[model samples]
Target: MHDDLIPFNKPFFVGKELFNIAQAVLNGTIAGDGEFTRRCQAWLEQHLGTPKALLTHSCTAALEMSAILAGVGPGDEVIMPSFTFVSTANAFVLRGATPVFVDIRPDTLNIDERQVAEAITAKTKAIVAVHYAGQPCAMNALREIARNHGLMLIEDAAQAILSGDRGSSLGTLGDLGCLSFHETKNVISGEGGALLINNPELIERAEIIWQKGTNRKAFMRGETSKYTWVDIGSSFLPSELTAAFLYAQLEHAKRINSHRRTLYLKYFELLAPLAEQGHIKLPALAQDKPANAHLFYILCRDANERQALIAHLDSAGISAVFHYVPLHDSPAGFRYARAHGKLQVTTEIANTLLRLPMFSEMTTAEIRRVCGEIDVFFKITSKQPCELS
Candidate 1:
């Protein structure tokens, strides 16, 4: 059983990922701001309808850039869900701002919008809403709150590309949006990300901060013969080699997305029975919202049950795993979160949730094999299954 250890997530690159890298090598422009970088940036802006898109080293970089763009600093507070990666909160925390961790929706695993208004106060400078598991967050409510309170909206769309509402994209719904192209993501370039600017006001500053506090972007446009340092910034850009690989993925975006969606639906359909039997809670899609099915996760009854399910899968040669340890529980966050509000759902769901094998190139047989193990676990445990399909 241990012979074939199906990983929880794997990067699937069938496009010109290697070909483009070779191209970048031949071009001798493997640094940032190369042709591939510009191409990927343009592709994101055009498809996602963003005014400007800046490619960064990772989603963390993009979020840090957002922190700079948002003017987050000491004494400021950023509201966000505790059920997320550290970068979601650390971006603002790095700027000396406090992260006002909130509870998540029990169903969707996204930030609970209702709790947000209650948490907003005089120090709340921004709201970082993460579209958890590629599902759109309560953007309408969050946007309204930001609008009425004059706060900035920064969307962590790392798991959500091409996942949005009726017409508007997920990242575009906020002032600034961050995306990841980590190997585990639906799209991969080994390690890369992008910062999408929705509000036009931040475009100039965004470029400045991205280029490490220089006016080099303007100089590139022939606007200035000499560019100099002007603001606080860092080298958040990635190499052109990375961008080149990303461009190849973007070229076959349609096909890659289609393959991932196929595998996603297969898992959903195959695991429907287990959901109905109350063994696990399936990931929920937002009403009328389109998601990339970027991940396939389920919530077991408890920590013990989740552990048992994972063990059972492991014994059967399937590799399933858990995601995000609640920041409130982690040592680093414990100090700052000591005085924060209670994280009731965050702590609970953090233990119960389990992520299954999900990748673009996964076969139907793989889904069935994984689901078979899940079904066996539920039957053996005799726990109430979640009513989901």
Candidate 2:
């Protein structure tokens, strides 16, 4: 199986990851808030058009920070999709706020905008819009809903660093946005994230929270004579080494994104037959927006077919996998949150979805191999004896 193995995801290198890490070390400030960290933050703020961007240890940390900034306390409720990473819900759950799980759109797999409006209650404090697979959620609809309901809009743009909707960047469309640089992302630094503060009023307090509840950022800027704890927070800043690697990757982001997009288009071309023949369903790109090629997945006819297809891929020395289970049915989710309505689409996608091998470094041959394996699976299954017929 190890021979000619194609992993579901392979980390891409832009040819400067290590050299920049070395430079960060030699600069003698490898901890945090060093030159590299500042540069990374500045680049994100300028690129994303956010008032403030603070690098964090992880997207989860950034979400936790947003929970704090949003003033989500006990009895307050936060609405989000049930088909997202746990960090999206856990961030607010940790603050004693209830996460109201909702269904996602079938095409974009993003939170349903109409459902969001219906799910809001008197106790609701915020709405966390998770841009599933880098396809942005309906931000205009969500923003209008938030404004009408007096709820804060937060963007969980973990997989949407270089993506945008309509004309605005994903991270700048909400009151607060979180970005991840995990190895699986378009641009990565192994395990890094950033908090995008769109609301200018939250910038000062965000810096305080990012600096471990202290005024260290202001102190470093000579605006404050002494730095001291002023709010509740944890050590969220990432090391300068992480920032250095991130900066290097960001420098070549255009090339990396372009390469990945080509692979995505190739997948679409290769798999169009399966889709047209009703053997599988492919993701539908947003018509008015742009994606960053974060992932490529297909939906089998049912859970059984999905499992069989995965087995076929595995036997062929390929790695394919399913995504998140519905959060409403999860143990932690049951204990920490409530379901808004029947998660029909969410549950269906969870069972039928299969993520194929996709990476910037992946070649056309690998994509063909994966697509061929799918064709082979259906061909074999078609010849199998029906148990009940």
Candidate 3:
């Protein structure tokens, strides 16, 4: 093993990143939506095949823009899974809409499509489907429900960039989609995101919302002499420096994805036996869906067992961590869902799920070492006696 502990997620940077950022700075336009931003936007549109896109400071900003564009407001209800990053719900909640929490599928851990329909109400405005850990949700089922209810479908593809299924991109399947380039994601610009406007009608309004509520973009296009505030908006656009950094990542998207996929599969192959032995449960892949292999996680018997495994890994100088304590039990989400109902699966998985280290830079040797340590932990604690080689 290496001298230093393996961090959970290490952002990989190519040689061109700093150079591009320097160019952005030296070009005298470090502000948002400059040359680099335009380049990045063009790259996204080409890669994702979305009709339009607007770069934002973060995924949360992209989501906030989606809420505004969707006309979500007070008295409106948005259906989404409770087992997600708070930003998923917070974006809609900030717009004064109540989030109707749904349970997750125990297999893939993505939002339950069946439960989503039952959660829909007359006030439902949108359905935010989070592509949990780079796995695509059941978009077809969700789409049917959304169409039946006449609600907007928003894809929170924060962890699912470059992930999709059935000829549909993860984010592009919905009315609007959001992508994150956070340090933790497969791609990194330190902190940045983009909103994918699949609908042509939403493009103009999406731009207006991104440019701080003004028609400045149209003005610059020679459509108008002057621009003014025409809608509720905020400063959501990201600087050219961030876009420049992201462009480097986007340029190497295939390479980065290939490396991450290698590591993801390595973990799965090494840990499958332990799962079969009843030591831990590995995340199940859906046969019908395609995924980006963004994360590799296992569910322990309970919270205590999960904690013990984490401690064991730590003792061996490996760093492993748990993720998302089901939003229904979270302080803010619980308060918001006071009148909704209980989230049984959400609460249960929150305690059992433990995310393993996954990054594009991780070497196969390092993955084997990490899996070996986990195997040792399970053997020492399992019903069967430990047999050290």
Per residue, candidate 3 scores C-alpha lDDT tens digits across 1-389 of: 54868888887776589999899999999999899999988988888889998899999999999999989889998988888898988898898998888888887788889788778788999999999988888999998998888999999999998887777778999999999999989888999999999988899989998998999999999998888999889999998889989998889987788778878878888988987777777777767332677788888878888899899998888889999977777789766753245667777789889998888788998899899999888778755522211
Q: List the residue pairs that clash in candidate 1.
A: 277-385, 278-384, 278-385, 278-386, 279-385, 279-386
Could you tell me which 10 consecutive residues in candidate 1 have the lowest summed lDDT? 380-389
What lDDT would each prediction earn against the true structure?
Answer: 0.87, 0.90, 0.86
Off by over 4 Å in 1: 288-290, 338-340, 383-389
The reply for model 3, stretches above 4 Å from the true place, is 288-290, 338-341, 384-389
TM-score of each: 0.96, 0.97, 0.96
lDDT value, residue 46 of candidate 1: 87
Write down the lDDT that model 1 would get. Answer: 0.87
Between prediction 1 and prediction 3, the one with superior lDDT is 1
What is candidate 3's CA lDDT for residue 225? 86
- Best-fitting candidate, measured by lDDT? 2
Candidate 2 per-residue C-alpha lDDT over 287-357 given as tens digits, one digit per residue, 9 for 90 to 100: 73238888999988788988888988999999999999888999998899999988999998998899998
